[model samples]
Target chain A: MLSKSAARAFFLSGTLLFGAVFIWLTVDTFQRIPAQTNAGDLNESVVRGKHIWEENNCMGCHTLLGEGAYYAPELTRVYDRRGPAFIAAMLKDPEAVYPGQRRMVKYDFNEEQISDMIAFFEWIGRMDLNGFPPEPTIGMAAAAIAIPGGERPQVFTQICTACHSLGGVGGTIGPALDGVGDRFDRGYLMRWITDPQAVKPGTQMPKLELTEEQRNEVVIFLSKQREAGL
Target chain B: MKYQSQKVAYWFFATCMLLLSLQLIMAFAHSGFDVLHPWIPFNVARASHNNLLVMWLLAGFMGAAYFIIPDECERPLYWPRLAYVQLIALVVVGVTAIIGFHFGWWEGRKFLEIPRPLDYLVVVDVLLFVANIGMTIWKAPKMTTTSIVLFFGLLMAALLYLPGMIPTDHQTHDAFWRWWVVHLWVEGVWELIMGAILAYLLIRLTGVDREIVEKWLYVIVGFTFLSGILGTGHHYYFIGTPSYWLWIGGIFSALEPLAFLGMAIYGVALAKKGGRNHPNRMALFWTVGCCIMSFVGAGLLGFAHTLPQVNLFTHGTLVTAMHGHMAFWGAYAMLVLAIMTYALPLLTGRKLFDTPSASYAFWSTNIGMVCMTVAFGVAGVAQVYLERRAGMEFLDVQRELKVHFIGLILAASLFTSGIIAFIYNFIRYGLPVGEVEESVSAGAAAAAPAE
Candidate 1:
């Protein structure tokens, strides 16, 4: 029984009302975005990094803030998950980082560009995205058991764990490091960790660039990973 | 054909077929098919695939408008030569953007990946199109709701493209404004175009009274904006926007399906009510199919994840892809195909509507798309469990999902076959050399009720 004029009135009024509300919400959102997203921390490097991101069409593969193509990993929390050094190393040579995995087009960025990208991601990771990239509720319980070795080294956690599992955790790309001490001694561990391909040609692992102190720290930590007990 | 200028729509449709085939080829390459990976790369293939889709759909819409406006206005198109020029410019701009994407000359945003310079050219080309269509409607002896609604949709779509071009250093702001173009176009103004086109088809194919159909058109589009305007909040929920959008987006987007449901019912009921069936039964099938599938794909599947709770986990996964492929196919792609089915015979003066290939095109494409959605859905649900819930590494999860991509490729191949059949039929129709039939003009006069 609805007449044409009544339907037209409903359309006009509903659109006007909702349109007004949407505009008002947008205005309020802009006002609050500065604090929520830490707008002041958007330095020159971060801005340039955003340009690089757009220039390369990075969103064509990877996602940020839960938008973009689903071909690659979501990168909103990549800054927190993978530290700056690992991010830099990966950007320098993508295939070397995760060889024989899904391919990443190597952009061949210089150090400054890599650092700029890291800075941009650091800024993004600090934003209050209303708790996005949610913590895995079911998997944390299994990964929470204490390791037999002493506290893991910072360098090992940042770089080594990306490919090698320490105990029951880390990536499965390389072998688990649960009993690595039983398999290789401290000197051998140092040599292999520093230059994987030199020791064993055609290995999947790349030669990870590590500082002298960091290399010593990781080797010591791996040496303590005995199967019997620490 | 009633108007000599309507012949121009055939060229537009022809371009659509070509672009669509190119889009599918790029899709296979982007899906890690390996053969084109060395040449195309994932990003280039993705950019080409998505941009080609948008380009072809825009062409189809333009073609549909050109063909329908003249018939509805009871007059020839204004500046028909300009339509040809506009099409050429659009194709040139589209080709440049796709090639530039390969060479890393792009803006890098999703959907709005066209480079900045080409963006300006696109704006100019669209404005020419709007002006040409606007003048035709303006000079008509009598105006109808269908033509006016279609014209308004096109004009608003052109104006909305500006928001995406707004300069922003902050990623959050960039995303915020990009949705203004993407979301608003698909869920908002594009529905207006869909509604008008459906109204035009129902009136012609069903022999329904224009008053009843246009009356329901207002109600359906009324429901569209009432829900869709606020439904923009759904995109804001996770994009660093204010938290209040959680409820605003959730409540409104839940209502989005009602508009689509209304369309489906309207199409079916009108077809049954109007006993006088036009000879173009294939067009009617497509029109009705678009309505029902839009409800299932855009309405139901979209609702499956629009909620804040489910979306918290499924935010950037293949689940969104599942919803997206079907929604675009049902809503926009099928709408264009429906209009093409209706207009092609009239444009070419060939009654090839009820051929076996026509029916095959309809069934195979629908079944293939459904299979594709299922493959994506199974992969997506598994991904949500392994990656989001189980906290697995990204690559480990992807390796597990590789088999699903194989399934997707198989489904896509079937879909492509349907498209090939459709294009084969299109080519078989030859060209638009139809003369104006006096009897068809009388039917057109009857179809257009006095305002």
Candidate 2:
């Protein structure tokens, strides 16, 4: 049904394009900045963190940015998103929070390496990465404060319900925090609010779209909602 | 132009399109270059692309039905109010699904991202139309030029989107079936759409032989869908799929571009051999631009990373994004413009748009598209070199290329402007407006020697 000439033309065009663009991209690639620097950035925290991260093999669950495996959530935003205390606690007790997951193997990371890991997260958190940061603005000030309100639950539904459960109504792709205030103090909430990395490092929760006021109000609402009559 | 019947579908379709375009623009603004952005991920982008395509396709299909269904049936739209309900349902479901995606409650497929709850709604919308379109065509004394192409394209698209909805565990499996929805819809089914609209516009304006045009249609599209649907294999070469996929995908995808190139060369040639001396040139502009873009975006860059060997080096890079960006918006969205071109004139009493303003819009859209494509491609290639193959860490790569990436974003912004200009021009002349004299036309002199 097809003409031989047209078939040949197709081949000819394909070859020409292949040869030309491939050559061009190659040359262009070489001419650009060297593709990567050596992996051996000798900074102490980086090396220590590298050892700890690899020792832990964080890629088993969390992705680093978009690379690695995706069984775990992304750790690329962990430093700014999670706090040291949470990471330490999670490592200390695998099933304390995530009893449902595969029992996380306890890695024997030393204090210095833990600090380095925290440093790694801190470094990544502060990095001026574009194309991320859901709203892409640095905080003006902590607008959320300790607030007393019944309206907080409504605000929580509007903002946090994407992840959190409210009266067992929302999705459980995330954890249930029905009585979190019994364990977590205001400081814990504030750190989690500001950047969870300040409290628990490498948590899977995305930074909430909370204004300081909204976050505080929601926190107050969440903090106080212990059973109808606890 | 209420005509007592078609007004409801048209308005609803138009409103949905305007909103979908806004969502797409915002998604682009935030997508950055990876699937791991703090806000949205592969899941959200998948939803955005799928939902946007769905809404646009629904609107385009409904618009076509409203225009040509009457002529086909030798009567006004069968139950225009029914069509109107379909349009409203499409908007409601489309808006809800898209919001669900952005707000993060969507299935994690690359294309089949309609919320599971709303899937039945989509089926109903499709069913409503199939009955209407089928009946209109069956009932007609004879189908018109445009109705045949459109009826086949949209109807088949609904059929093709099904395989993608199959439940699957592996991402690779999902991606495979997803292409059945996404790829066939664009290259397979939508080609008819694009071809049908082009045929209709040329018929309306160029005074061409419909038989000749129809013949071209018959040959041109068959090859594209045949090769094109299979060509979707290219996407899977690197996603941990089978090895044979490499050769199968690579060759077919390479063939896929040839079809568009053939269409481009042939389209311009046919236009010339056909002969036209008309103003209101944006119709022609949209058609020609669609082919050129389809070739460049889907063809050129698509091959750049289709094979497993190449995809290992280029997958998830900005280059893939560039190709999709151009191909989706440029190929299909612009075809919608082409359809609007003819339909507007026919809808309005004016024979054509005021030439000068249309020219500005045309230039803006083309230039904007070109800028966007090139910017994304260049930045994407740079990213592949720096990140994937080079093995640079994310932050380091960002620090190194921040300025250039910013420039690329600005270029993206400009492309957005171009799209706005396109819609603005569409609204101005395409609407029933009192207009004045001079017309600007492109040299429709045929592509020299169709060989």
Candidate 3:
């Protein structure tokens, strides 16, 4: 038999108590956020990049820090996952990166803007987000098929894996590279890695912007992908 | 209607219907309708969709307040003209913001995408609304619990808008404060508004004793803030906030359902206890329906993911949408509709209640929304498995989820039909031109045996 006065007291006291606690926690959170999110990394470029992010309403499609529209991929860890080259290239032309898939509105950002965006994402990726974007626990075991190559090169991981699969651990857009070394020679691998369009007139793979050394590295790595043991 | 000033609420409800239609169209375009993609891109459509939902709901709340305050206070509004001016200003600001969103003239935040200049205008318009309502209550011969609770909710909602406008360069800090406006309004003060409105409706429609209804009102809203204030922690868990938030958010948010459950029980029990059948049976259906659905939608479904463990996967996925669509539809959307249905007949002197279309509107919208939630849930769960658990590529998973969006579209079409029926009923009722009748309260009249 709760009376109205008692109910009113319950509401007033509970709200004030919890509201105060929330404000105190907010203050404490602000204190810790500087270190947790690396507030010092809030450089001019990153700030400008944030402005670009908001100005373009990127969150309308993509998510950051596990907030925003779910139409696009979560981009909080994009810098770490894709690396600068891939992000820069993708920003330059989104459809070219993921052809015939979900379309991204191309902003035609200049080099400086691209770099700024990269920096912003880099800063975001480093934050301690209570272990968000959790590691894919169930699929990682199946995807970790042993590659014939001793060790995959950085160029292959950062650029080639975006479209192509290596030991079933990457994208499905391109053919699997499990026995690629057995199929193609070093010369062809080198040429194809340098420019897929040149090797095949109408290949879906764009001519990846890679340095000579990175191209060689990718070619060597692909050439080692033998069906048999390395 | 007892007061001439109550007529102003009709215009606000009309605006609501208009905005709601526009919102549905934008939502369809945003959900991969190819023909409108180039004309209304995803961002444009999304910003408009979210903004329009907020705008229309605000209008509904304002309308509900205008209609209920005069009836409760036993006096006419202090400045009825100002209510009209406020509505016009709000519509103008809303139209400008929606147009600006298309041209990339926006702040670009989700739910707060109205441009900075328009944000100021919105604040001014809301202030005018608050002042008008406040003055009405101030000059009233007597004050009721419902009027006071409703007024406080509106005032606090206006104040909460400021936190989102706080300037921030750091993304984490930005998110932390943005939730102050979004979370606090929906979960916190808005519940106060919902509670008060439900109290008013239950009092009038069910012919329940005002003492009994208002007493429970305090308890329900008491439970609301008791849990909801700390429930803001749930948003903080993964937004670069501290680890402590995980425990705080998980524990408190788990309790959030109790408040909603109370609401459901309150509505059902009062309807049974009153034992008086009002002529406006449709209004009672909506009122009771809002309560039950809010529990299932906001209370139970929200609990399904509020935990830190499950949320670790479902965060930023379509799962949130599953909960969100029904929660808003149940808690806020239906609350507004309940009040609209209750007030419409009295406002226009139309006996359109209990019509077949009215019942069809109720059933179709509820069933359609539930189906939509199921579609979102299926897509979302599949997405979590493929993308989060299995680490499939984002696009690969999205391609897989396309079929669910088709299901969503189907459900949305049914929901839209219900809305059309509701709007048709509204139009048939015509305008709020009913004469001011000197009579007993609606509850007392309903309680007496029908003549």
Taking all chains together, each candidate's TM-score versus the true structure is 0.98, 0.63, 0.97
Report lDDT (Cα) of residue B80, candidate 2: 65
Model with the higher DockQ, candidate 2 or 3: 3
Instruction: Provide the clash count, candidate 3.
Output: 0
lDDT of 2 by residue, B1-451 (tens): 3244544434644664586576556557344454244455444554565567757756875776676566434555666677777777877888798788766455544455566678878878887877777776777687765577678777887787677667643333444566667776776778777777766666545657666565666566656765665576565454334445567667777777766776777667756765555565667777777767767776666666665566655554556667777777666777666666655654544564656656666676667767777776776677666555443333344445556556666666666666666566556644443331113111221211122
lDDT score of residue B433 within candidate 2: 30
Cα error, residue A193 of model 1, in Å, equals: 0.9
- Looking at candidate 1 chain B, the ten consecutive residues that score lowest on lDDT are B442-451
lDDT against the true structure, each candidate? 0.89, 0.58, 0.89
Fnat of each prediction?
0.77, 0.00, 0.81
Clashing pairs in 3: none
Q: Supply candidate 1's per-residue lDDT for A157.
A: 74
The best candidate in terms of DockQ:
3
Better candidate by DockQ, 1 or 3 = 3
